[model samples]
Target chain A: MKAIVNVGLKQGVLDDQGKATHHALDTLGFKEIVKNVRIGKQIIIELNSSNEEEARTEVTKMCEKLLANTVIEDYNIEIVG
Target chain B: MKAIVNVGLKQGVLDDQGKATHHALDTLGFKEIVKNVRIGKQIIIELNSSNEEEARTEVTKMCEKLLANTVIEDYNIEIVG
Candidate 1:
């Protein structure tokens, strides 16, 4: 199975990288890019799970254990066959 | 409208941050995280477009101009009203 984990900075969190990117974007003329600019991480993993439920369980554990920093980031996992 | 831009390393491209993350995952015991590890960026933009097609066009422009590094990343945009 294939799983995609999206880990991103929480709302209201300070994101220096995102700020830099926002500045760059503004300089390039996308001036309407309002308030928040938070960056996130995407992790694509291939696992050998036998089924979707199994894959979900394993991927959830993966996110909770290592794919995400629970304190400052939130993550969503999408399991694809 | 709101649009999400997902930008990620192209297949076969070197991803140093992803490598470091994979190493960290391994050290933390997710040994099953086999093979390639690629990282990507997600840009969620909120716009005042009146419709989906307009949002898509504007967001595509955003992606082409600054949200993605066309040389190394591939992006998908999803527009949500």
Candidate 2:
């Protein structure tokens, strides 16, 4: 199975990179339609586990232990065959 | 509409960050199940336009110009209400 994880800052946290990107977008003529912008991390893991549940559990553990800084970030894991 | 963009390195490109993370995962005891790991960026944009087609077009243009390094990366854009 494969696990795809998206890690993003919490709602109240200041996203410096996102803010910079938004400003750049505005300057590049997207100011009209671009209301806001937020950026995050996308992690893709190829796992030997075939079971979806097993993959999800392992990936979640990985996130808690290594992939994310839980104090300021939130992560969602999606497992696929 | 909202645009969710996932930008990832092209298959042949060497991802240093991903390699570092993979090494960390192995050291943290995920060596058995963790076959491979890759990392990318996820950019979420809130758009003033409600039209899905328009949002996608605009987001795609943004990707082509600023959001992605076309020579080494690939980006996928999904428009949602």
Please give the CA lDDT of all the candidate structures: 0.77, 0.95
Candidate 2 CAPRI grade: high
What shift in Å separates residue A74 of candidate 1 from its native position after superposition?
A: 0.7
Candidate 1 RMSD to the real structure: 2.1
DockQ scores for all predicted structures: 0.53, 0.98
Stretches off by above 4 angstroms in model 1 are: A33-36, B33-35
Q: Please, what are the lDDT tens digits per residue for candidate 2 over residues B1-81?
A: 889999999998999999999999999989999988999999999999988888888999999999999999999998887
Give lDDT tens digits, candidate 2, residues A13-70: 9999999999999999999999889999999999999899888888999999999999
Regions more than 4 Å wrong, model 2: none
* A-chain TM-score of every model: 0.89, 0.97
Instruction: Evaluate model 1: give its TM-score.
Output: 0.85
lDDT tens readout by residue for model 1, B1-81 = 677778998777898988987787677766664444667888777665667887787778878887888898899998776
Pick out the ten consecutive residues of candidate 1 chain A with the lowest summed lDDT. A29-38
Worst 10 residues of 2 chain B by lDDT: B50-59
